[model samples]
Target: MPVDFTHPWVGRTVIYTAAHPNARPEQGIVTSVNVEARIVFVRYGAGTTSKATSVDERLQFLDGSDLILWK
Candidate 1:
C-alpha cells in the first residue's frame, strides 16, 4: 500500500505521490505554500526545471515532472 498522505514525511518531501511511493525533490521555485489546502503553488520555469502543476491531492498517486512546494 502507498504511504499515507497525512504522514509527517509529507513535509520533508518536495512532491508527494503514490507513483514514486517515496519522497522526491522539487525541481522548481515555490511561490507559495498552502498549509490549509496542503498544496503548493509555484511557477513552472527554467530555473525550476519541473513544470507547473496544481496538485488536487498531492498525497495521492499522481506523479510526473511537475514541481511543487510545501511548508
Candidate 2:
C-alpha cells in the first residue's frame, strides 16, 4: 500500500517488518516525513555504546507492505 504523505504520521510510533529474517523488527517514532520522496525517518533503538550512535533510519513505504503503524 502506498503511504499517505499528507497524513500526519510524524511523532507516531511504528514497526518495520522486513522480508529478511536477519532484519530484526524495528520499533521507533516517526521523526520526519518527506512527502516528495515518500520516505519517513524513524528513530529506533537505544544507543548503549555511545551517544553519537546513528539509529535513525529512512523508510520508504513500499505499497504499505512492510510497515505497520501503531494505533
Most TM-score-accurate candidate? 2
Q: List model 1 lDDT by residue over 1-71, tens digit each.
A: 22234543233334443346565644334444545455554443344433334555453223454433354
lDDT of 1: 0.42
C-alpha RMSD by candidate, in order: 11.2, 9.1
lDDT of 1 at 27: 38
Worst 10 residues of 2 by lDDT: 47-56
TM-score of each: 0.30, 0.51
Q: Write the per-residue lDDT of candidate 2 for residues 1-71, one digit (tens) a residue.
A: 34443567666666665667688766666665555444666667662321111223334343443443342
Off by over 4 Å in 2: 1-7, 47-71
**What C-alpha lDDT values do all the predictions have?**
0.42, 0.50
* Residue-level lDDT for 61 in candidate 2: 41
